[model samples]
Target: MAHLRDQPAGVDGITIDWDAPIRVSDGTVLRADVFRPTEPGDYPVILAMGPYGKGLHLADGYPANWRRMHEAYPEVAHGSTGRYQNWEMADPEKWVPDGYVCVRVDSRGSGRSPGFLDVLTALQARDLYECIEWAGQQEWSNGKVGLLGISYFAANQWQVAALRPPHLAAICVWEGFADHYREGARHGGIACEFVKGAQARQMFTVQYGMGSRGPTDRNTGRPVAGDVDLDDDVLRQNRRDLYAELLARPVNGEFYQERSADLSRIEVPLLSAGNWGGMGLHTRGNVEGFLAAGSELKWLEMHGDTHFNPFYNDRGLGLQKQFFGTFLKGEQNGWLDRPPVELLVRHPGERFEPRFEQEWPIARTEWTEFHLCPETMELRTSPGASGTLSYQPEHEDLRFRLPPAGHDREFTGPAAAKLRISSATADADLFLSLRLYDPQGTEVTFIGSNDPKVPIALGWLRASHRRLDTDRSEPYRPVHSHDSIELLVPGEPVDVDIEIWPTSIVVPAGYVLELGIGGRDYSNQGTEIENAMYPTTGVGPFIHTDPEDRPAEIFGGAVTLHFGPDVTSYLLLPAIPAP
Candidate 1:
């Protein structure tokens, strides 16, 4: 074949001799390193293609990740030789031990593969499609293929599955984001500051720039993948700098849509895994992708804690096996009849309680509203008399607390806040946080997506990027029409409705629901969680404060609150049913 390359030494399949790299219609050579049972027969193949060098062991590819993972998750070290372990994805040790054949290929410009790396482009999807067909034709392959991985590996799975490759059977997308524009890279019309800052260290260097950043084979002193000479200059040319480029253009528009996957075309059987604490990278997309994808046989499972742990834990692994057994093997595993939605509801003190429900925004949810009382800065059942609470440059932001519900309450899913606002400046930024305070007056912060130590749900905004997209606007989520901006008039309060991202929490009895409103972001303080694996500020995870993006002059302003006769402000919460 024109695109095929020479077979490497350790790549021959034990069960059936596999063909070397084969060319596809697109004229691109893709190399595959394979593992199969030492028997002469065909079997379903599990395929994964990404920049993490296939031949590279975790200890060599990313030593820090290896050290941290094993330190936190000792079970990862219990299996086979641990030759196939990688960061933030499936432990190949578990998969290869089973009957399934595992194949890993380096994406173009990464590992041994040669080319300029373009992260998650339409062309990348084309390459994956070819790889699927190539895998199916292998001598040991049963001509049926399934895909599975976390984050980058899983995100592209959605893209290629939409193409509906003939040999493709099923897929498990673990903690993958859905839309590149709205749900990822950019949030609330703003570039994700955390991803922007950590991209180079977290993704590029290991994947493309440096072949082996960890221990080397004592004999050759070379990487397990190839030559380890890949350095900084090569990294600069390897892939499009997603985090940096996103920072230059902080608003959503055509530039962001190029990489976003169109979910309407995806029709294969799919299982989406989500993490509750994965606020920064993986959380939103998992939730949105599950709801948006066109798959009829689809399931969503959400859990708490470090993003990757739950997926590989005993419980996570068991669920994945049952799901694959039913879908890929055509077995009558109970997965076919399992509930559509499953959640590991978290309580205080690191306790996780399991709950299985049919759908999200649970069926028995009570969509309730609490109005802002202007006079006393309190959240009341109804509006107060005519008056206003205004925050000038010298005044503090208005704070309000709602009376505790007699019984415990569960608030989950998306929430909304309606505000009547006037700006002294032409444009204004509004920061709102719906919080829960305990009986001891301790503010509760759940694990956020970006910062692991603090507790906060979804965050959102309107940079006045555009006027409201009237057709898509709803009480719970305000769909902004990023088409035009209407300048504000001083002293005139415009009815600006803000949509907060989804979150899940069970408020204990005697706990008060508090809402913090301000012209700028609130400080992430109080509780500091310990973790040697991830970066942390003084007390906890790093808080985002880019002077260029979050300057007080541009975002901070004196804003008024109206709960009495003159104005009304309130938050709409997705209240879940009590047990």
Candidate 2:
């Protein structure tokens, strides 16, 4: 057993219990660090469990994100020493001072915990359930526990909350994806490489057994990984190959089901904070999860900015504290009186206006359809005369543009595209982008989760995997059944519906809206910004470029857009009428 050390109260009036043991169901001990108020009375607990090392400081593990966040929003580090800040987890300095106990646990096989490492699986969720129960039973705990964090820390909450542990009271999921198949590994049946990159840079570096090879926590002067040093081969044998497993399981089967959250089973009070800029990875899950969750008391708050910034900022922290205070601490904070939906409505020039609403898709939304006119490459209110447009899938794309708007229009909900198309080969990959152009014809882009220049919305689909799940499909959000593949015969046009993830954009008068369809990922032709982990090429690391997934023989071919009286292709947008 490792020696447990309890540090004296610091200048900030917080005490720390280091290397605390939390034994799970299998009797394997997981490690955690507990921070609580020194004045000591039982306090409501806020817990986070994930693969990221609990000992690794945010400044040390993710320097780029830490530097960028502090540089842009200095308030993120305000009111705290910033020494206890971990990636995506609550800063203990901030929470402990507010009379909340903050506990950070290293999941099995990562950080200081020693065990086989397979993340986001049923086992991981079970471990989290045990941890929550453990926190509740602790003498220093007030018998109520709340879950709070961003991204990985947030994503796991949905799964664990379904277990309904006695201690689990509420959750604040900030920018987390609930679906492992659709949102994390694959997007519209296309293999996304983001998982691969994430595993390499985020997980592998601080993996358990790295010992001397891994970084040390500056605060404790101890290795972030365990003390026992292990060879590279031994380390490789301990962790699962996430990328290989994703490639092996291309469909949403038992593998994905075991990892994804059962939204229907989540009954705890939920506050899902989503980012408008997190289109490919984080956006869809938050909106869809909030709607599907069985929780009667749930709220959705949407904002725009870099993914990590909002979670730590005043707006994000305020919402989290209010919700947790009401549910976990039993405070009469009037949280129940707040509206169910809160939106930081986005507009041109990086401006966001805060608006309270009754429900998502805004009850007053006007579902408008803009039909495609292939002859002139225009989007019209009604279908035009029959015409056809073809483009080389490998080299070109078909773009249809809407004329300058007569008045400012707000598109604040879900969007989709219905197209009639054919391929020269048996299979073709379709990449769709919803874009806005200024009066001068310059493309309008916004800061995304990782990329600085992302378009209005993006969607993707492989022709062979275009089968829709009728029971779950909506006109605006088409859910695809990627279990089966149906090849397309040459020159035979077929109708396919593609779901463009939810987006919020207020288009000013004289601005043009365009729909671009291509065989490859959409690029804005803007200079790429290199980040700490990956290069930001308009879409960030959420790219699909695996050669095995898109073999040239099957996916590389000429694609045609058939626009005729019988074959009508159009873009459906959620248009909000003027109040």
User: 486-576 in candidate 1: lDDT tens per residue?
Assistant: 6566566777777676667788889887777765445555444433434542212223445565556655556665444655478888887
Candidate 1 positional error at 490, Å: 5.1
The estimated TM-scores of all candidates read 0.86, 0.98
Which candidate number maximizes TM-score?
2
lDDT of each: 0.66, 0.89
lDDT of 2 by residue, 1-579 (tens): 234333455647888877789998899999999998888699999999999899899888878788888888899888987988998999987788888999999999999999988999999999999999999999899999999998899899999998899899999988999988888898888899998988888888889999888988776778898898989999899999888988888777988888888899999999998888897787988998899999999999998889888888887788899999999889999999999999999997789999999999899999999999877889888997787788887788988998987899999998999999998889889999989999999999988877778898999988888999999999999999888889999889999999999999999999998999998888867553434467676898898889888888888879888888888689999999998
Candidate 1 stretches with Cα past 4 Å from truth are 1-26, 52-73, 207-235, 390-398, 447-450, 483-492, 519-523, 526-544, 550-553, 562-568
Task: Point to the candidate with the largest lDDT.
Answer: 2
For residue 394, model 2's alpha carbon misses the true position, in angstroms, by 3.0
In candidate 2, residue 210 scores what lDDT? 92
